[model samples]
Every structure is written in C-alpha cells, then in structure tokens.
Target: MAGSCAPWVGSAYLFLQSTCKAIALPSLYENSQKKPSVFRALKLALADSTGSVNGVDMLKVHCSHPHLIVQLKFCKQENCRHFLRSYREGALREALQNHLQLSLAITAVPLEMELKAGNEHLDSMLKDEDRCLEYIYREKPDRLRDEEITELEERLKGLMIHQSTSNSIPVNDCTSLDSPSLPCPSQGSSLSPQVTFIFQGQQFANRTLTPDDHQKFAKLVSKKWKQVGRSLQKSCRALRDPVIDSLALEYDREGLYEQAYQLLRKFIESEGTKATIARLVAALEENGLISLAEELLGLHSNEDCS
Candidate 1:
C-alpha cells in the first residue's frame, strides 16, 4: 500500500509540475508576441512569392504569400542578428535604387536636362511684356546678383532717356514740354521739395537714378547703415535681428566693405537698439562679427556664465 501510494503521489506531483510549466511557457510566448516591432532592430529583404529563403539561414522571411511572416524559430536557432542587419541594409539600398529608377522612368528626364528645361520655361515667361515686371519683382534677392541689378539699371536708364526725348517739345501747354513758367530742375538752382520728391518717385518707378541721385542715395544709405550698426554695438548685449546682421554681412562680403566697416563701427559707438540687442551674439558668427559685435557677444556670454 505504501509503494502504491508513493507511485501515485510521484505521478500526481509530476503532472502538476508539467501543467505549471506548460502554463508559464505560453505566458512568456504571449509577452514576447506582444512586444512591438522595433523599426531599428528588424531586418527587411525582398523575395518573390515563389522564392525560398534557403542558404540565407537568417531571418528567413519566406515571401510565400502576401502575408509575410518571419520564421522566428529559424532566426533564433541561427543567431542571425549580424546577417539580418546586413540583409536589411542591402535591402534598403536596393529599394532606394528601385525607387530612383522608377522615378526616372516616370519622368524620363536627366537632372541637368530638367533644370535646363525649367530655365527655358522661365525665360519664355519673362519674355512676355506684361509678365516681365511681375517676374522681376518675384525674383529672389539672392538670384538678383550685382550683374543683374546693373543690367536692369542700364535698361531703365535707356527707357527714361527714350521717354524724355520722345516727350520733349518746344512750346506752350503745361502738359507738353518747355513751359518756362513750369520750372524743372537745372544745375544752377536748388530743386523745390516737391520737385525733389517727384524726381525721387520717378527714380523709384524706373529703378534707376542719375549720377547725382546715386551719390546722394549712397551717402544716405551709408549714414543709415552706420546708425543702425552703432546702435547695435553699444548695447553691450547680443544682437536681436539676425536678418539685419545677415544683410550687413552679405553687403560687407559682396563688395560693400566700406559700408560693413562703418556700420560695425557705429554699432560699437552708439547705444544699442533694445529690439536688436539680445539677438546679436547667437545668430552672428563669432569670427564673422566685427570687433564691436564681438564685444557685445562677450557681454552676453558673461551674463550667461554668471
């Protein structure tokens, strides 16, 4: 009876242990299955529906059907992490290549040729008289280089000369030319304020100026530039307006060295503009900023350090 009882007890314990093991294993599997796919960890490969994952011996994604299931058991047994990584990289490269090929096929264009075609279209649009002014206005500043500006100025000057010659007449009406009572600007006399304003307006419309007007503009621009620059410099703080600083730098680098130098000098000498003071240091490059701008940046850094 003791022996029979012993055997029964051992069998009961073994059955219970087996049942527990089975239950625990399923829970572990469930947890693993619940794990979200890590985009960085998983590998990808391309294979036809009929293709076998034979010899790859890695994360064998047998594309037998549309529902591509990974053979988890095979991957685990093979210790295929390295292989899978390489496979994924290769797959990615191939995918990129295929994409580029498809894009090219759809467009049927080489990049250089495409750019040339676009430039041709832009030229065609610019040729239309009604559209030319709009096109010029819409052009990006960077695209309007010094050469383009110079060319436009020359063209405007030519237009102004042509208009003046065509409109000039010897006699009578106020609307027609040559009314001695209707005073026009001459070398001997100072223009009235209204006449000066009108001339300025005409220059703006034409986007061209006479030599005297150009000199006056250059002086005015230089003065204003210096005023702004000095104010920024005296702030003892960082610059706030990156756009202004960027413009200043561009002007300096692109043949306006004198303007750049003067502006930087003024910024140092004058009390800084409150609006622009805080932004100076971070946006302006350390090496690129003038001595005064550098000093201002130093003040900011010191404040930050404190």
Candidate 2:
C-alpha cells in the first residue's frame, strides 16, 4: 500500500472481496497474510487473462454469421477472444476450426464466477478429442460429403486470407493435425530439394514448402499412422519381403507434433525427408488403395495449392 495508488488499491480490495466471496474458497479468504499480494496478483491476472470484477459478457461474440453456440468452462482467452498462452491448447482451437468447422469461444463466462464453479459444467468441455472423431470418419445421415466441405472450406480460407494482415503467412498460423492432409497429381515437389508436391496453376506454385511441408506431411501420415503403417506393411509384404519398408522409416516420434500433440505421435524425423508423393502413391497402389491414393493427393493439393 506504501507505493500503490490508494483509490485503485481500495477498488481492487472491494473487487477481490466480492470475487473471493463468490468463489467460496475458504483457503483463499482464510490466508490473511496473502490477501494484499493475492489482490495484486488477481489484478495482474485480470489484466492478462481477462477476468473482470464487474459482470462482462466475456463469451458473447458480436457476430450474426451461420454458427452454433458453445459455452466453454475454462474461459482462458483474453476476455475470451484470441487464444492465450495461459491455456497453451491451441491445437484444440485449430482442431475445432479445421475438423469441426466450428469457431471456439469462451461462452458468456463472467470469468471470476467460474473460478470455483461446480464440476457439472466441466463435463461439457471437450477433453478427449479422439473419442469424437467418429463424427468425421463414421457415417451420418445429414453429413455432407468430404469433397464438398473441402471445396467450401477452400473458398472460405481464400476469403479469410485475403482479409488477413499481409505481415504474416496464414500457413504459419496453427496447423491442425486433425485437419485433413496429403498429394496432388502430375507435377511433383522435386523442383526443390525439400518439396514433395507442386501446384502448376496456384498462388503458392513458386513458393518452397521444404522443411515446413515436410513436418506437416509427416504429421498427416502419423495422424492415421496405424492405417498408414498397415498399408505400408501390406505394400511391403506384397513383394514377399522387400528390401526396405515403412519399418525402414521407423522413428521415435518424440518431438515437434509429437510433443505438442500427446497422441500416439510416433515418427522419425527423416521420414519427412525421405517421403515423396510418388513413393506414397506407389505404396498405396501396391496395397490396392488407388482411390485412397487419389484422395490423399487431392487433399494435399487442397492444403498448399490455394
């Protein structure tokens, strides 16, 4: 209180009293020595994490676009807008954007009220992402075809990129492993040592994907790696014991996507370096996945072409 502004301190004290009372956490109030320091900490947290003493509609968005409503239990975004490092779960954010075609937000939380709220609402949150992927893979009556969604998503993405700041590459934004991925037909990524595919009539044709595309491609493979590994095994076994196999590409998968996404992300770093669209296609063909091969190529182009 010696160096702090008196009026601001008094206001913060009252805010904390109300918030602490609402939270109903005995330890928070009982710790008398820490009350001032805790008040200061909450003040900083309110600034950084968007917690307001006065009830602000922190989760309401000022939008009328076609959408669904979602109420998040953990309202971590700055007043629940853009993602914050405090949560460090941007992958979930990207997954909703990429897979579910859903925009995620904080959902009308007043922030402090949820500090020690009941666990009932916590169950509503998306904890296990893998459990819900059946919606994508498994059939549904009203579900639109992947091709239609892909094309529509592409158009929307083009519009979004056009409206975005030129200072940053949209591709440099969060990459979703849950996002569909993999190759184009005819031309190859062979023009550059690091590239594995190319689009002849697209904006990114001249750009080099190299190391960036490598990681993305590898993660795509590893995402459905059980399937990829099985297909590779089939292709390898088709030759009645080939000289090399996906087993040859065996890796630790302990970094990058592996660390960021804590799924069964097993891969070797060199797999991306060694991979080619042609080689993957050949393997798929050997395993009699010609249609799947086409889909992979198609999705891959959709990724980098626009």
Best by lDDT: 2
Give the alpha-carbon lDDT of every model.
0.26, 0.28
Quality of model 1 by C-alpha lDDT: 0.26
Candidate 1 lDDT over residue span 159-180, tens digit each: 4455434433332122212221
* C-alpha RMSD (angstroms) for model 2: 19.7
Candidate 2 yields a Cα-based lDDT of 0.28
Reference-based TM-score of each model = 0.14, 0.25
Q: Count the backbone clashes (under 3 Å) in each candidate.
A: 11, 6
lDDT of 2 by residue, 1-306 (tens): 113332111000011111322332233323444222222222222222222322111221111112112112222222322112222343222222222110111121122221111222221242433222222112112322235234443454453354322222223222333322222222453332332222211112112224443444443322233344445444233322231233233334453344222211222232343344444544444433332333233321222221
- Shift of residue 205 alpha carbon in model 1, Å: 49
